[model samples]
Target: MTTDGPPARRLMRWRNAVWLAAAVLFLLNFVQRGIDLFSIILTAIVVALGFAVEHVETQTRRPFKNYLRVALASFALGLVLVAMPLLMGAGIWIGLILWAGLSGAALFWCTYYERTEPR
Candidate 1:
């Protein structure tokens, strides 16, 4: 069966906070260019942390392996994003699109294969 009530409510609150933080970071990146490297790194770390938080909040168990994989992916993506402007001489718009697409895919993977321990 499904769960309901306080626990679910708390989880929702945590999820909202994470999403808000991610959005704010993304917006900040859009408005500022001097800190592109820092922003990219911070965004990746934030996204990874958010995923870990969601996993813990939902499953009540820490999946270290999955977390490590996500962290590595985030870092690698961030590096690629940081290089896009220099490597391709592309504008921030293109970089943002790529970042968004990559981030969305990562989030989707997390949701699609959420951990569930055996009884």
Candidate 2:
């Protein structure tokens, strides 16, 4: 086997490892170069814009909500991506602020969204 774990559990282990690696890299990047509002906004904008590619790949007309979702995420993240760097210095602190903002927005959204709605 290419991996050490059992075949059934290998995928999960790799996924967890990838997550850990991402966390470490994020920390390191924050400590070194900084939050990089431009980079984060650019990354988020690019990701959101990628919905066009997703649409093409799926070859299905999605609902308006999908477009709205993409737009809102881009606008919001881009806003936070800019604000955090300005509010906090260009350091790990910006990362913390961004994380807090995102978490708060998520929880706020969750509180209003219908819990009964199927995932």
lDDT of each: 0.67, 0.58
Residues 47-76, candidate 1, lDDT per residue (tens digit)?
776676566546654455555556556666
Q: Candidate 2: which stretches are off by over 4 Å?
A: 1-6, 42-119
| Best lDDT among the predictions, by candidate number | 1
Q: Which one is best on TM-score?
A: 1
TM-score of each: 0.37, 0.31
In the range 14-117, model 2's lDDT, one tens digit per residue, is 65686577567667866887788866765555455555544443454434444445445645565567655655566556655676677567655654553544
Q: Candidate 2: lDDT over CA atoms?
A: 0.58
RMSD for each of the candidates? 11.6, 13.7
Clashes of 1: 0
Model 1, C-alpha of 23: deviation from truth (Å): 1.4
